[model samples]
Target: MTGKEEPKEVRKYLQQSHDRIFENNKKWAEEMQKKNPAFFKDLSAGQSPEYLWIGCSDSRIPAEAITGLDPGEMFIHRNIANLVCNVDLNVMAVVNYAVRHLKVKHIVVCGHYGCGGVKAAMTPKDMGLLNPWLRNIRDVYRLHQAELDKITDEAKKYDRLVELNVYEQCRNIIKTAAVQQCWAENEYPVVHGWVFGFADGLLKDLKFDHEGQLKEIQKIYDLTKDA
Candidate 1:
């Protein structure tokens, strides 16, 4: 009954939870080996994924599982709300490497309808250090305020915001020099915006027009002209 000690049930649960991860890892490795004897050897060599996925760091949605992509098939970068900020070196670095080195054919920005990050941005409160990160979502709301304001239901409005956030992030990716220059020369790395619905466990394609959007963006943010 020490105040600092955890209960026996809690300790037992913690131990089992920690042990299960290794147990599952061993089982998964064995299964992979049984399917493909060279799976580990191939995985250890290098990765050449065809797709770059920027998605929300939500535990409920596993990108590869939903898309039926195996390991090394997709390069994934996850954050609170799947934002692609110009000043964020981390996401920018990933985009640069994915395009320049990996030469991924598709770049996807996927958000979800019931995202906690988007919901927090919708709320009028200070979230300490998260304010800057969530402000990107708020900016998305501001840009589409007219359309969002007209919606009568809050739930529908939230869903719309999530979709719009994904759209804006996709636009951000297209604005990058890595994507623009690569597309100009190679015509690959098509950008897409998708929203995942937890209710149905399905992804909804926003059908982002990569070529059309690029044409419009290059009118102002053109980086390939000099390249």
Candidate 2:
């Protein structure tokens, strides 16, 4: 096969699959409109979402699908492992818009059980460019090394790391200047840590209080007075 050449079945299914996807989308749109005539109209006018979701990019775990929220009800940002990297401008921009512009009341940092990202980070192998990204998770493990090292079972450690990753990302979001500023002024965007269970189709809340934790850790990371 040349640079452009491909198998016949591959080409056939590519078109057929896309055609089916569009067909499904059309039917979905019609069903939505039939249920609510103003569904698209309201969605197109402008988005005023009350929540901003930071979640993993796993296709099996969609933020909207699990939350049972309609489109435009929530502003969403998805990435590998749902990391809230302070250095990543992509998440910062989403937080900025969601907080300053949309005034979203809640921000959910959701990770899933059996996350491949968490599993990869748990191993000792170096994964090239992923090293820099995975380093964030490594840092989380290091911070909680005392607790994690105590867990004997590797599977339990992996799952525990998944929850801890979400907790760390939630803390990262709280550490941001934007979130700090908004939290000071109105406390509109409350950050949360949650884990999705693929086995049972449920989202588990880690139950870490944003304001309370902020108060406890504010001794070190608080920037409200500096601002």
Candidate 3:
């Protein structure tokens, strides 16, 4: 051949990651099968997850792995800062399907302490299209600006914003039509707010729980007659 063979490192660089990823997948599936012969079979039949997890798109925090749950245990939807914007149809669809179809017993809005979205929202520097998405977090800060401004420590302020953002998004879920209908009919699908501490690799519930908070918000937001 006229062309010399490519260098080993160059060839490796040109190769796609499919080989390693598939190898890992094969190993993972085999391990699951070894653990339980019916694991994949049962998962393939259908997913009847009890929870719908609305979490940050950050790779470090996978909804199932961190929660000690199996693949079919939780329905998932992820976005920046785990937002539940009323304008976002993607999240609304997930919630509608989970509450109305899957009948998930819990809906979780999980944010992480070191969320890039939240940090970016707190800054004045514009992030182009991301500015619109991150503005949701900024609105949360505006709602609790007095409380947030008092926290002179920047780190503490960031953490507080993360928690507050979770609470607001969880509230958004509570305000959804599908969730209200499901709660009225099935009396299920409670909403929860939580934060993951990157340092500890633990989930800490923020206690902005739907059951208790619903009564207060019902006066304004509840659409179901009996609820």
| Best model per lDDT | 1
lDDT of 3: 0.90
> What are the per-residue Cα lDDT tens digits for candidate 3 across 139-214?
9999999999999999999999999999999888888888888887888888989999989899998887577777
As a whole number from 0 to 100, the lDDT of residue 21 in candidate 1 is 100
Candidate 2 structure lDDT? 0.89
Candidate 1 backbone collisions, by pair:
none
After superposition, the stretches of candidate 1 with alpha carbons farther than 4 Å from their true spots are 1-9
Q: Per-candidate TM vs. native?
A: 0.95, 0.94, 0.91
Clashing pairs in 2: none
Global lDDT scores for all candidate models:
0.95, 0.89, 0.90
- Two-way lDDT contest, 1 vs 2, winner: 1
Q: Candidate 3: give the clashing pairs.
A: none
In order of listing, the candidates' clash counts read 0, 0, 0
Query: Candidate 1 vs candidate 2: which has greater TM-score?
Result: 1
Tens-place lDDT digits, model 2, residues 87-198: 8999999998999889999999999999888888988998998999889999999999999999999989999999999998988888877788888999668998999998
Better of 1 and 3 by lDDT: 1
Once fitted onto the true fold, the runs of candidate 2 whose alpha carbons sit more than 4 angstroms away are 1-6
Expressed as tens digits, the lDDT of each residue in 26-108 for candidate 1 is 99999999999999999999999999999999998788999999999999999999999989999999999999999999999
